[model samples]
Target: MRKIVHIDMDAFYASVEQRDDPSLRGRPVVVAWRGKRSVVCAASYEARRFGVRSAMPAITAERLCPEAVFVPPDFGRYKAVSRQVREIFLRHTDLVEPLSLDEAYLDVTRNKTGLPTATRVAKTIRQQIRDETQLNASAGVAPAKFLAKIASDWKKPNGLFVIQPHEVLDFLAPLSVARIPGVGKVMEAKLARYGIRSVGDLRSWDIFELERRFGRYGLRLHELAHGIDHSEVKPDRPVQSISAEDTFDIDRFRDELGPAIRQLAEKAWQATRKTERLARTVVLKLKTDQFKIYTRSITPGDSINNVDEVSALALLLLQRVELPADTRYRLVGVGLSNFYEPGQLGGQTELFGNEF
Candidate 1:
């Protein structure tokens, strides 16, 4: 069985802030901008007790924890610390796949550190991170990436959990279907309607029945219910997509999205310059005041050339919105996807002229 380790930094951003400022150590700390349009980037353990969470509106966080100390994000500092922790992981294994600045998956089936077990490698890495960065990390060791990820979150915040190959089924049995990776509230609700509440319940269904109900995803659920995940930890995975989004201080109507779309498109375009790949799709995303999300995208015959091209395409997508005329949106986003090497794109003419 392959050995995988998933390491997750504990409240990484808030922890860094707390570590640097001793006065903020015991107090509730929230890393976010101060505005209705802003979202919480991170919350300390103290803040979390008051129902504060990342991605929630900053205003809501403030309401939930009136005493919470809000601090703006310092991405430069966070990235530096992440690099330090990455170096620690490299000492034991080269098969590291970073999920974000604060979490990663490492395949330690054949570690360079000569560790006796994957658990040993994980412990050493966590300790090294704590010693060097003065930050706590939680780790999970398992035979598969998905299980390792789940185990990493079980005890959370400077914790460690292990799932041996033989213990996979028993470990996952009583857990809620929501614990499976990629199974969100929608999927959970769907499964619940079918009387499938726990992993064990899901295990009772055959792959044929699942596939008939959930299509290809049903087949995936069958495997996960049986504690099977064959995906590997790939280092330096290529960028699949890049996007920028902004929540408005007040809800806006469809016609008012032109400026926001252009601005976000410009932001996404600037970010794309950092990568060598070309983007073939322009996407426009909107979230209604009721929290429903919609996306419209177009892939021209040729790769998008410049910010203006993306901005124009994104703005054009505004007409594609089929929401009620009185509908208002709380958020808007612009994105570029379908990344390809320059060699993969041919010299084809633009397929759709901007007929707007």
Candidate 2:
């Protein structure tokens, strides 16, 4: 059995902001740009009490917590802190897989520190992070990555939780199907219609029946319900895509999306600058007021060069939207994908298409 440990920093970006500014400590802080179209990057625990959360509209965050302090995100400082945290992880194990700036999975099955158990390794790492960086991290130790991810969030905010190999089935039984990764509201409701509300209920169904109903995903559901996950903790996973999206306060016609698309394109383009990889494809995503999603993509002959190029191509993709003129959209997104290394861009063919 694998001994996996998942570490999650508590409100990482906001915590860093608070740690740097003593006056901001103990106050509700929302990390985001100051604008009507801006979405929150992170919220301090104090802000969470007021129902503020990441990816929420900044206007909505202000409405929810009128007294909250809004700070712009400082990725430079956050990345520095993240590097410190990663150094702490390396002290315990080399098999670390970072999910984002704030969370990671470590396979401590054979730790470098000679820790007696994965739980000890996790505890030590969390303590080291606290002592070195003055940051609190929650950790979960389990025999599998999915369960470890879930356990990390169970107690949350500088807490630790462990799931023993023998206790996996019992631990998962009563949990809602939504607790399983990838089981979103749509899938949950579909499962609920078939009397599958909990992991235990999903376990009772035959694998064949599940596959017949939900296709390939049903097979995955069956395996997870039985406490079986074969996925390994892959370290140093490369970035697959980068994107930014926004939902508007009022539904808008397709023609009205230019400003928002440009804004999101700028955000996405800025994100791409942080990586050495080049993106060949530009994707534009739109969600109708009715919640139907459509995506249009284009691959230029060369990698994108600047925010202006991203904005121009994204706007061009917007022209490809075939939805009715009367159709109003509630959300739009801009993304860059089809990554290539610096020397690998020659002989690339331009491509364009739309996906449902």
- Cα lDDT over the full model 2: 0.85
lDDT of 1 by residue, 1-356 (tens): 78999999999889999999999999999998787555677899999999999767788999999999999877668777877887788888878887667888899998897878988888898889889999999999899899999989889889999998878899999999999988987799999999999999999998999999999999899999999999988885666889989989899999898877876776687556444568999999999999999999999999999878998999888889888989999999999999887788622111000000
Best by lDDT: 2
Provide C-alpha RMSD values for all models, in order. Answer: 9.1, 6.8
* Prediction-by-prediction clash tally: 0, 0
Those runs of model 2 whose alpha carbons end farther than 4 Å from true positions after fitting are: 243-253, 256-280, 286-294, 299-312, 322-333, 340-356
Taking the tens digit of each residue's C-alpha lDDT, what string does model 2 give over 241-265? 9999888889999889998897798
TM-score computed on alpha carbons, candidate 2: 0.85
Clashing pairs in 1: none
User: Whole-model Cα lDDT per candidate?
Assistant: 0.85, 0.85
Q: After aligning candidate 2 to the native by TM-score, how far in Å is the CA of 312 from where it should be?
A: 5.2
Cα error, residue 252 of model 1, in Å, equals 10
